[model samples]
Target: MRNNKEVNAVQATKTADYCLAIIRGRYPSLAPAEQKAAFFILEHPESAAEMTSVQLAAAAGVSESTVVKCCQRLGFTGFSQLKLALVRELATSREGAFGEVEPGDDVPTICDKIFTATLQAVEDTAKVLDPCEVALAAEAIFKARRIFFFGVGSSAVVAQDAQLKFMRIGMTAHSYLDTHAQLTQAALLAPDDAAVVITYSGRTREATDVIELARECGA
Candidate 1:
């Protein structure tokens, strides 16, 4: 069994810019009560981050334990840890601004919000993305015999985009959006294969299963 250190390290390295994306990607796979908490968080990341587990429970209309379990289901140890992560993301995320959109807002206001939020999101992400991490990842990709992109939902589109770009550059790349195909390819990978899982939340059960299977096959 993995130790707490391993589990925490794995969970701690999740994407900071796309918590809502993550929630959405894995939302369909979560328990019903957890889905309620996820819905509350997606629409109210700031409020949810500031709330206690009990308060979140009240807001999400579920039990406190359900909120806690939701956190666990999303790869967090508990509410406070997830809350802190959300707060960090919120400070650097454009979704916070977009989350405040009202149904009655004008089209001009909506367009402006989207444009500015997208620019801000890019700028914020650039500030935090490490060049060393990019270099290491690139080196690994270059050394691999083949590259596989594993994703679901919107992330699957991202995987396909990546595959297209890599193939254009004459690289051996493949993307599997279908869960069954992803599992099949993962089971068939060789020792020198490299797979990048592209889910924003990094908590999708199907994606995680593919990664594990690939790892077991020495990918």
Candidate 2:
């Protein structure tokens, strides 16, 4: 028979996975202020789980109301519920899928860990995606006259790959490695154009500039 501790561990794992999946899946659609709070929770789930709404808002450089709204957007009742979910998730993650490699680990062990982490990431993403949002985004892209992809550092590689794929399908797509070129392209975007900003962390100045300019130009 399972002990109380084992049962609690399993429950925590399930709750944590659900909470994290929601945050990841809805992140792109959140407002800039709400995204700030959500990104903080994603990057510091353990710390965020322990913080009050005001404290989390301060840490994330957003307002307290933003934090509350972010929680609501994720389908939580309030900050308290979000905190509870994060706390449970952190409890189960202490040595779970996100575990880091130790110096003494073998190559096979490292490979296994990498594969496990990759699988877990994919599973979490699959859980939180909203079908409506996906369909809307797909339809927008399908109808766009041109598409602009923006990114920096490693994300730029992804942007370039996307640009190549779209071009292969006979769509006009652009991805610039230069910041100046990106801004220039963004300024020329019309209402019929679409822009996709790709970044691991949503706080980069370059990405913010591109998004703002693209929106201003009615992309």
Best lDDT among the predictions, by candidate number: 2
For residue 115, model 1's alpha carbon misses the true position, in angstroms, by 3.2
For model 2, residues 1-219, the per-residue Cα lDDT tens digits are: 457897666544544467876686667778899989988887777888889999999999999999999988777779998898877766766423344578999999999988876876787866555455678888889999998899988898999999999999999998999888988888889999999999876767889999999889887
Please give each candidate's TM-score: 0.62, 0.64
Alpha-carbon shift of residue 113 in model 1 (angstroms) = 4.2
Residue 205 of model 1 has an lDDT of 88
User: Candidate 1 residues 1-219, lDDT tens each?
Assistant: 457896555446663445555565566678888988888998788788888899989998999999888878777778887887788777875465434456998999888877876775575456545566678778889999999998999999999999999999999999976889988998999989898988766678898998899889887
lDDT at 81, model 2: 88
Instruction: Please identify model 1 stretches exceeding 4 Å from their true place.
Output: 1-32, 35-52, 71-104, 116-133, 152-154, 176-181, 200-206
- TM-score of the candidate numbered 2? 0.64
Model 1 weakest lDDT span, ten residues long: 15-24
